[model samples]
Target: MIKRIAYLTSPGPTDRRGVAPGIVTPGFQMEFVQIGTPTLVNDPADLMITDLAYVEAAMRAQRQGFDGIVIGAVADYGLCTIRASVDIPVFGCGQAGLLTAAGIGDKFGIVTIWPETTAFTYDRILRDNPVGRQCVSVRYVSTVAEQAEIADEDGFYQQMQAGREGMMLRILAEIEAAVAEGAQSIVLGCNCMSPVASILAARSSVPVIDPTAAGYRSLESMLLLGLTHAKDPRLPAVSERGPAFAEAVAAVVGTLDEPEECPVCVLDEYGNASCEAPSHEAAPTSADGTAQ
Candidate 1:
C-alpha cells in the first residue's frame, strides 16, 4: 500500500493552499510540503524568480526521504532538475495536465494566467511531449499588467472577480472555438482554476480537465506502480536524510496525526466543497494507534 507521499511546492502559503487538497484526497495519505518563502515578482525580467522556489522544493524533497515529488506550479519550474536529482519519480502538474488531456480527448485547450507565459507554456508542452500538437491552444486570462493592477488589495478580490468573470468568458469562447476547431476537451492550465473545474464542466458541453487533480492522480498511479514492483531500483529507499531535510520531516509529523482541512475546498471563492481532502476518520488505524 502507498502509505506516504510528499507534495513539494513554492512558498507563499496561499499559493500552496490552492494545490494541496488535489494531492491528498481520499485513498491516498500524502503530506503537502512547502519550500522556500513567499515571493512576488513584478518585473517580467524576474519572471524566473519562481524557479528558485521549486529548486528549493526539489532539494528539500530529496534530502528528506519522499517516495515521489509533485511540483505544484503549472509552469512546472525545475521539473527536469528535480527528476534528474531524485531517484524517485518527480511529477509536474503541467506535464500531468497535458497527459490527462491526451487520455481524455483528441485535443485540449489550456487556460493560463499570463499572456506572456503562453508562449513559454506552449514551448514547454511541445518540448516535453511532441504530441502537444493535440493541444488546441493556450489561452491567457490575466496578463502581467492586469495582475499587477490588483496584486495588493484584499485578496485581490475585486481583480480576481473581474479576472474570473473575464476568464470564464474567455474559457467559454475558447471552448467553443476549440470544439469548432476539433478539440474535444479543455484543460485548466492554472492551479487557481482547479477548484472551479467541476463547475465549469457542469455548465459546458465538454469535459474540463483540472491540471492539479490530474497531477495528483498521476502520482497515485506512480505510487501504485512503485508499490506493486517493490523491488524496483527506480524507487528510492526510505532512509534518505540531509541537513536541509528537517523541514519536510517536521511537515510530515505536523500533518500525520492531525486532520488537515481540504485545501482546495477551503480556498474556493465560491464556497463550494466538492474538492475535499481524504477523511481522516476513514483512515485505518489500530485502536491503540493514532491515525496517520
Candidate 2:
C-alpha cells in the first residue's frame, strides 16, 4: 500500500509559492502544506506563527488520515507536540539531518542559510539528537543583503542557474571549512538549501545530506519498520480536561458547534452543577498529568 504523508513547511505560503514539489521516491505520496502568510518577514515572528500553525496542523493530521507528518523546517517547530498528538510517524528535518549524517560519517557540519537562523538551527539539532555532539560547526551561505536579493524570483533562479561556480561558491567555501574542522560529512541545515544540495555533493568529495530529503526518508524507514515515536516524556498522550479541550479545539478549528446555551449537563469538579466556571481548582491538571 502506498503511504500518504503530509509535509508541513514552516514558511509562509508565498515564500515558495511558485516552487513545485520535487519527484518523490516510489511508494509514498506527499502533500505539502504551509503555515502562516507571506508577509511575516521577521524570523522570530515567523517562527512563532509557524509553531502555532504547526500545532493546528498536527491536530488535524490524524483526522486527515495521513500515515505520517514531516516537518519541513530544520528548526523543527512543534515537533514534539505533533508527535504526541498522533499515533503515526512524525519526522523532524533537524533530527533526520543529523542522524543521517552521523550514520554516514563521524563529525558532521551544517551549512545553513541566513546568519540570524544559524543559532536556532544549531540549538534545535542538539536538543533533538543525542549524537549532536558529533556536529562540529555551522556556517552560513548568504548574508541579509544576499537573501533580500534572492527574494526576487528572477534573482533566485539566476543564482540556481549559475550552479556551483556562481551562487553556490560561498556555501561551498563554508562546507570546505567544515572539512578542515574535522567534519567527515556535511548536512544542509535549511529546507531552502535543497536545490543546491546536489551541487554541493558534486563539488565536495564528502557526503552532503539534505535536511528535507533526510526527514522524508526517515519517515519512510519508520513506516517500513512499523515504528513510531514513543509516547512518554518526549510525546505524552493527550488527556481530556473536562470540556476545555473540546472547547479550545472548537474555538480554533471549529471542531465542535457552539451550544445554543449549555445543553449538556455535567457536574463540576467541586460537585457543583454548572458549566460557568470550574467550581474548584479542578485537580490543577488533567488525567494525563498535564495542565488543563
* Runs with alpha carbons beyond 4 Å of true place in candidate 2: 10-25, 36-46, 153-164, 233-292
| Top-TM-score candidate index | 2
| Tens-digit lDDT string for candidate 2 (1-292) | 8888888753222233112356466788887654432112133443454455565666566667888888876777768767766678898877888888889887999876555434653665586788898988877665544433432434422354345366687778889999999899998766656766778898986899878788888887898899998888654464223244334433433322332111011122222212221111211110000000
Error of 2 at 24 (Å): 3.6
Clashes of each: 0, 0
Tens-place lDDT digits, model 1, residues 126-230: 577755788877665554444333323333223333445555666667666667767787776666566556767877677877777777678778877763212
Name the 10 consecutive residues with the lowest summed lDDT in model 2.
283-292
- Estimate candidate 1's RMSD in Å: 11.8
Give the Cα error of residue 115 in candidate 1, in Å.
3.0
Give model 1's clash tally. 0
